[model samples]
Target chain A: MSSVSDRMLTSDPVVEVENLVAHYGSHKVLDGVNLTVNAGEIHIIMGGSGSGKSTLLRHLLGLRRVTSGRIRLLGHELDGVHRSELQELRKQIGVSFQGGALLSSMTVGENVTLPLREHTRLDESTMAIMARMKLEVVNLGGFEHFMPAQLSGGMIKRAALARAIVMDPKLLFFDEPSAGLDPVVSAELDELILRLREAMHMSIVVVTHELESAFRIADRMTVLDCGKILISDTADKVRNSANSRVQDLLNRRPRVEELDADAYLARLTGE
Target chain B: MPIWMHGSWMMAETRLGRVEQLGKRTLGLIAEVGYLAALLTESLYWIFAGVFQRQPVRVSSVFAEMMRTGVSAIPIVFLLSFSIGVMLAIQGIHTLRTFGAESQVVIGIALSISREFGPLITGIVVAGRTGSALAARIGTMVVSEEIDALRVMGIQPVRYLVSPVLLAMLVMLPALTIMADFAGLLGGAVYSAMDLGISYAAYADRVISVLKTGDIWQGLIKSAVFATVITLIGVANGFSVTGGAEGVGRATTRSVVLAISGIVIADMVFTWFLNR
Candidate 1:
């Protein structure tokens, strides 16, 4: 279970997405997007709102159809796969949704045990035990009986993490784990993410806009802007990637309201 | 140049053309709605027939669904029916008193609940509570990719998700209607006993004398139709939700509106047929 970052210096890509294009009606949400994540490495995808980062993640998970181009996971072409076969392919991957997306109707234990119940023929007691073990791993040991609605923001995320790794998938996709959390909580989640990758030896692709979280957890990173990849590099190299768009995003300043009041008034008055 | 004559003629022609366009559009929309209704009816028939195919219907899932629909909905249904019953009794008493027919208040309230109000109110309540909740849950699931997760897990969203809910509502709605009718009667009885100084036994007797099997069955039928409409509308709205948070919220609101509208239309059709 060596870190892929060490081996990524010379190795095959674990996930390959090339010239990917996706659309919502006439809007080209993902345009010629290309990305690669090496085995056992944490890859971060960062973008502002409507930058198609989430859309790209869905494509990687095969949740959305690629309007054009190619997406290959572990050397298998996703575009050529049948729907049933895609489901089979997806079992090898895990996803944690933007808000943790735990089934609110089900107890935390039930949520953790779902993939096992669906993909395996395990008996009830064994499934329960396995779910408990996963919960324990996420430090949510005693919260199995609680519903997802009852869990705190942090607890829900941990529970979702437990569920995502219940099957010990080869690849894990997390969507915005730190979006709504405080900085300290976000950092804690980042540490947990790194720990999970280390323990499971799984490749992770975290889709987020949080620069600090990406910088902390990512071994390699891609910056998506206007439906295109602005940069993809090692975390250390990415810091000095010197791409203007990426730098503009990472660099922050106070936004001054420099409105042209006369022009605005003229427009309002139908001038 | 006499501008007035030409302009008047042009305005008349424009008004006539607009009317014709609107009429055509309305007709086209009605035709589409009719086609969709036919398609849905056929599909539901096939689904119902499939239940009796090689593999017998699993009683457990249907039973669990029934429990969810019937048991969970009892409290709200009772409260609604109780309030309606009280209101109807009071209204009937006031109206009937003018003609020295205040005694007929029992029959009026009882017959209304048994035939119409019981089912209609229950249906609307179900739409507001169960239908909207189901839509929100399913819509959020769609937006979150949880529904897709289920599909990737090899579980059919219809079978695992919608069918349980549909079955639950179908089995439970009639039962809820029955409870609603009974509650309505109890509410009327309580109102009559307290407000009108009528004995409980007398009120019960008046209600019983006027209530018929047809009335009860009509309410039951309305409830069943309402349940079906509510479930379908909820699921359709849910599956349509796109984007993120705002889309989900909008879907939930739309589902309730659709469910309520569907219930009203279905009730009207049923009522018309029952009268015919």
Candidate 2:
């Protein structure tokens, strides 16, 4: 399991994006965003609704086509990398979507073992053992046979986490790991994420709008608003920043904007 | 332009807009055909390449699809084939009876069922049943992000999902066609014996004499083509799905409509070739 990532220096960037610009039709979704996640770190990207955090995460996962700039995952530039090469690189990276995305057709155990079956030739017994080990890591022990439909929302998230880490990815990206849950379950997930970083020795990038969870687990935090980075720094610095928009986000204040009569009329008339 | 001239200009603009829409539709169809070809090619590659690899085709998934696409479809195919078979025999008796040749009904039943109705009817049923199901299943997966999960896991969705279902369709559609043929024959036999006063032995002998190896092979061959068209269209429509639950419904409808059309068009071409 030892690889170049293990030997990399602490400051080495595992995930890097520079001047990344993206669009959905005529609307700009991500506007000149720059971000980096160093080796063995938890970098949280936090933003309010429609702030382009999801789109930025999609770009990092190589799931979206960008309009400009560079996205380098572990050293491979994703912009025009060969499909096969991208797939090869994907073996070392994992993603958990906001929805658990567990195949409804399969049981929880089968879901966890899916990546192994597709990509590895490990013996059946070994595969089972490794899947169980991952489930235990996520505190889902002895629930191997349960169906995903049978799991609670929190449990589904944990199960998705188990599947994501089953491959022991060097770079893990999890989307909204605490979006839907009781406060206690959300805290448990926060703790699990911290434990995962400690044990797996991997860089993790989490995308979320949950401020408390973001501050609790992030080694460094990047705050994005309306497709631009407001601040990228440690938790304390980001909170203390003098930026008005960042403060607005932190204090959960309502945004104020002067109305433009002509533009507003055009929008209303569907022009 | 003057106000009076603006009328003709608006008319011309409307005509041009229609043409532009037509052109876009034509291009969209062409792109969908391209998508179908790519999906089939990748599926075939994995099916062949899996021979050297250890169970890359995922036999369990294939069997599950077979149950849905073939085995579970047994009752509907049987009922339709049998009813069509009986109607064909009755009509043959009526037409031939005018010339005192009603006894020849077995030849018509045997030939038509084996050469035409078996594959065509079975294909229509499957396009409605399994084809729509395929689209709905994959469309749901796309909306739910399961497809993305598979992608991020380094597994190609077409390879992991489409290939196994395609293989199942390839194997099971032909088997259902054979069953359809048998059901049709039984229906004809029962009708001829009871209504036309034809003996069971006489009907069986006549059917055996009329049905040729070429007839069975032709039906089987058409079933294979129909199977390919149905799976390709279904999988393509599923991948093209957008939005959410509503998108899945649209994809399902498109898959059924397109696959049924493909079956009929292919059947027409095959019939033309046979006649030639």
Question: Isolated chain A: TM-score per model?
Answer: 0.90, 0.93
Taking the tens digit of each residue's C-alpha lDDT, what string does model 1 give over A88-201? 777788788777777777999999998887677789999999999988888899999999889889888889888888988888888899988989888888988999987888
What is the TM-score (0 to 1) of candidate 2?
0.94
Question: Which runs in model 1 stand beyond 4 Å of their true positions?
Answer: A1-14, A74-83, A146-152, A180-188, A236-271, B1-68, B75-118, B136-160, B180-218, B238-257
DockQ (C-alpha based) per candidate is: 0.22, 0.65
Model 2 regions lying over 4 Å from their true place: A1-9, A260-271, B50-55
Per-residue lDDT of model 2, residues B1-276, tens digit only: 998799999999999999999999999989988888888899998898865644378888899889988999999999999998899888988999999988888988999999999999999999999899999999999999998888888887887899988999999999999999999998999899988888888888888888889999999999999999999998888888899999999999999999999999999999999868
Report how far residue B164 has shifted in candidate 1, in Å: 1.9
Top-DockQ candidate index: 2
Model 1 chain B poorest ten-residue lDDT run: B49-58
Among all candidates shown, the one with the greatest lDDT: 2
Give the Å error, residue B180, model 1. Answer: 4.1
